[model samples]
Target chain A: MTATDRQATGATWLRRNRQVVAPVLFLLPGLLFFLVYVLLPVAQSVQISFFRWDGLGEPDYVGLANYRELAGDRAFEVSVINNVKWLLLYLLAIPGGLFIALFLNQTVTGIRLYKSLFFFPFVISQVVVGLVFTWFYDPTFGLLNAILGAVGLGPVNVLGDPALATYGIIVAGLWPQVAYCMILYLTGLNAVDPEQVEAARLDGAKGWRMLWYVILPQLRPATFIAFVVTIIGALRSFDLISVMTNGGPFGSTRVLSFYMFEKALGEYGFRMGYGAAIAVVLFLIMLVFIAYFLWSMWRQERGA
Target chain B: MKTAWTTTAALALLAALPATAQDESLSGTLTIFSDMSNPAPRAVMEDMAARFDEMHPDLEVELTIIEREAYKTQIRNFLTANPPDVANWYAANRMRPYIEAGLFEDVSDLWAEPEIAENLASTKSALTVDDKQWGVPYTYYQWGVFYRADIYEEHGLEEPADWEGLKSNCQTLLDAGTKCFAIGTKFLWTAGGWFDYINMRTNGYDFHMQLTNGQVPWTDERVRTTFANWRELIDMGAFIDNHQSYSWQEALPFMVNGDAAAYLMGNFAVAPMREAGLTDDQLGFYQFPLIDPDLPMAEDAPTDTFHIPSGAENKEAARAFLRFVVSPENQTLINGGDALGQLPVNAASEVDEDKFLEEGFEMLSANAPGGIAQFFDRDAPAEMASVAMEGFQEFMVFPDNLDDILGRLEQARQRIY
Candidate 1:
């Protein structure tokens, strides 16, 4: 064919296929990234979990050995239990945030200043938060002990005691987390229908009744987001634990994420297969929440 | 442009000097990845690289000093994908994984050289794995009781000669409202130093070696005996309170402020204590008091080392760099009081006249008749060392939890070994 004739044919084909081609072209980069960065690594992690490897030399297929070892591993048990504690205790931030939001949702002088002041914790890095709380809970000279001593109470060694270490770290985590949830609720409260509040007020609904029946339902989207973020934060609590206690006072502060790192890439940790196994277990735990979240969001979209 | 001019200048200088036969033959880029990121050690490493660069007219020496903590994890990455000609690492089981993976060059020939074979004999076994040497030791430090002499004198207590004497002194110190030892178990390895000294003293060096080598059960009665010895100090509250919350560095203020009388630590502790203003008269060094009179004394002397990656392109340049690192002259210069402030691996090298360095040298060489061990983490496989150190920390905190801790450790031993 002549060049012009071939070009005309190609242009005609492109014109016809533009609708399908354009969207796919637009999606290709993101899809390629998701596949390579997220999906491939996840698949590789699952595959590696079934092997015996130390990040050096060839990996040996060990069937279910790494998982089996995790089942019996005491450190793994402590990590799983601590992860649960983090999940349950971390949820406290949701209500804590809601209360702070309600209190701050006022038409007062410098309300913006108050809101920013309340949101301050979220602005700081988790590392700095961990360090600040570490000093705050210091047994000898910490503010916690200083306050306790004023009341004729204890000079409790919070982080030094395995029983108390995780709780102390959770408190540190909650500071920033509560601030995050507060910001979400503040945004959600702004979108709440004022006419519904007026209607509730005319119906003699106020305080507990108004909040329970009228306000809370309007805050559902924010609550859902808060729950999702809080759950994920609890599951991936590595930095605070690493910074504050480093899974210490004898590994009492370790969560699944921290344990996975300790087994895989920590100073002494090179058990790649075992680390991958822990990652798989953590992924499964997170999967349940993620699947639920996705389903709920899908149902809501359909309902709307 | 600056580098080119310096290279030219260095080449001209090398030509002027009577060049050694080996020096003329070495021509390539020598890359060194070092974890000597501390102020003094970083200077020493940079100086070494510059000197090495200057000595070889045609060879280009490149040095990267990673932060000490970061280098531990990053070494695994670079060794596999982008191997340097020479790299820094610790001795003993710390290097085992790299050796087994064949990432580290078998430098048995370097060890066979008379200069290394004769002078670096003390740390040879530490760098050996599977009957082959993998690296050369450059520096190490003695681990012992770094005590407050003023406090000892105030209490009229002499340096303890045996376990009984040590206990009595601790009792005296405690009675005087001072904690005996200021150790921070927060990092876990500080407790490992305590375990090493007690175990080495109680069961002798051979048993300590076998246990670390994973040939003995954690529940072995001999191990229990070691714990019982450690327990005496724990029960008496010899350690500072809330030690688990402090790092080794954080715990120092206790000794400096006289809240604690001493610390069981490496010679590196001396510099910090001095900086904290403990004069030589106030500060003292003593071999960890003998626990078992008949066992003969063994000591913990963690050796830091250098190795050429097996994947290195310029093995010859790397070997020459390693040789230069361990030569008596360089060893003395780099390990001087102002440099690493640690003992030189080369016996022929002069020990820095710093009080702690001299005392550490004398103890490691003349007094430690039984043997020398790399500290707990270096001697034991990484996984086991971490697990065992955690157990040690727990045991210190809750002495009553000894049985439970030992049971968990035994389980780990079964799994790990």
Candidate 2:
């Protein structure tokens, strides 16, 4: 065919399939990235879990050995338990954020300043937050001990004690997470329908009754996002544990992510396959929540 | 004037001939990856590179100094994917993984040379695995009980001679409201130091080596005896409270402020203690007390080394660089008081006149007839060291948890080895 005929046919095809082609063309980069960076890595990690590799030499097939080892691994047990503590305590940030958002939502002078002040922790780096909390909980001369001393209580070494170290790190993690959730709630609060609130007020809905029945229902999207982010944040907690205690005081503060890093990339760790195993376990745990989140979103979209 | 110019030019040519002849074939870029990121060490590294570059005028020396902690993980990546001509690493089992993987070049021929054979003999075993030397030691520092001499004098304690004497001295310090040792196990490796010394002293260097080598079980009777010895100190509250929260540097304040009487640490602690205003009169060094006097004393003196990667393109230049690094002259210069402030690896190298270096040198050379260990973490496999150190930390915090900790370590030992 002539060049003009070929061009004319290509133009006609483009016009015919623009609807499907345009979206795919736009999504090509993102879809490629998602496949290469995320999906491929996840699959690779799962595959690696079945091998015995030190990241230096050839990988030997180990089958279920790594998983079997994890079953009896005390450090792995501690990390799983700490992760549970983190998950439960980390959810507290949602409510804490709601309360802070409520407290700061009022129309008052310098409200912007107050909101920013409350948002300050989220703006700061996680490492800084971890370091700040670490010093705050220092046994020797930390602000925590000084306050305890003032209140006639004995000095408590929070990070040093195995029982308390994980909780201490979770609390540090909560500081910024609560701020993040608060920002989401604050934005959600802004979009709340004032007309419905007025109708509720006319119907005698106020205070706790208005909040639970009227305001909270409007904040559903905010709460959902908060829950999703908080859950992911709790599972992926590494920087706080790393900076504050380094999964120390006998590996009490290790979450699966940090433990995975310790096994794969830490100074003493080159157990790539074992680390991949830990990563696989974490991925499976996350998958349950991810599936739930997706299903919920799908249902919500359909209902809308 | 003409005669004088010719004579001077001839003298310069004669002086340059020896160096240029030796390095005549070295022409390509020699890439070096060093973990000497600290300011002084970085300067020393840069100077050494410059000097090596000057010696071989045609060769280009490319030195990359990575942060020390980051280097630990980065070494694995670079050694495999993009290997350098030479790299810095610790000796002993720290090099074992790389050696076993055939990444590090076997430098046994360097050790066979008369100069290296005689002068660097002390550290030869540290660089050896499977009867082959893989690297050359650059510097090492002694580990001992750094203490407050003034406090010891006040308490009439004269550097304990035996385990009983050590315990008595500790008791004396404890009675005086001072913790006997200031240690931070937050990083976990500090606890390894204690385990090394106590195990080395309680059993012997050979037994300690066996335990670290994974030949002996973690739950072995000898291992328990070592922990039993360590438990005595823990039970006595010899260590500082909440040490698990502090780093090795943070624990320094306890010793500096006289809250703790002593610290069982490497010679590097001397610099910080001195910086913290502990004068020579206040600070003192003593070999770890004799636990089994019948057995000779072994000391933990971790040696830092340089190795040629097996995949290096310019190994001839790398080999020459390694020789220059360990040569008595360069060892002396690099490990001088103002430089690394550590003990020179070459025996022929003159030690700096610093008091701690002198004492450490004397102790390591003459007194430690048993053996010289490369610290607990260095001597043991990385995974095993990490697991055992964590156990050590747990033991320090809760002496009652020894049985559980040992069981966990035993499991790790089996899995790792």
Task: Give a tens-digit lDDT track for model 1, residues A211-280.
Answer: 9999999999999999999999988899999999989989888999998998899999989999999999
What is each model's TM-score for chain A?
Answer: 0.95, 0.98
Q: What interface RMSD does candidate 2 have?
A: 0.7
Tens digits of lDDT, candidate 1, B46-111: 999998887786789999999999999999999999999999999999998898898999999999
Task: Quote fnat for model 1.
Answer: 0.85
Off by over 4 Å in 2: A1-3, B1-25
Task: Write down the C-alpha DockQ for each prediction.
Answer: 0.81, 0.92
Instruction: Report the C-alpha lDDT of model 2 over B188-258, residue by residue, as the tens digit.
Output: 99999999999998899999999889999989998999999999999999999999998999999999999
lDDT tens readout by residue for model 2, A44-146? 9999999999998999999999999899887899889988899999999999999999999999999999999999999999999999999999998999999
What are the lDDT scores of the predictions, listed in order? 0.92, 0.93
Task: Assess the local accuracy of residue A81 in candidate 1 as a C-alpha lDDT between 0 and 100.
Answer: 94
Sort candidate 1 into its docking category. Answer: high
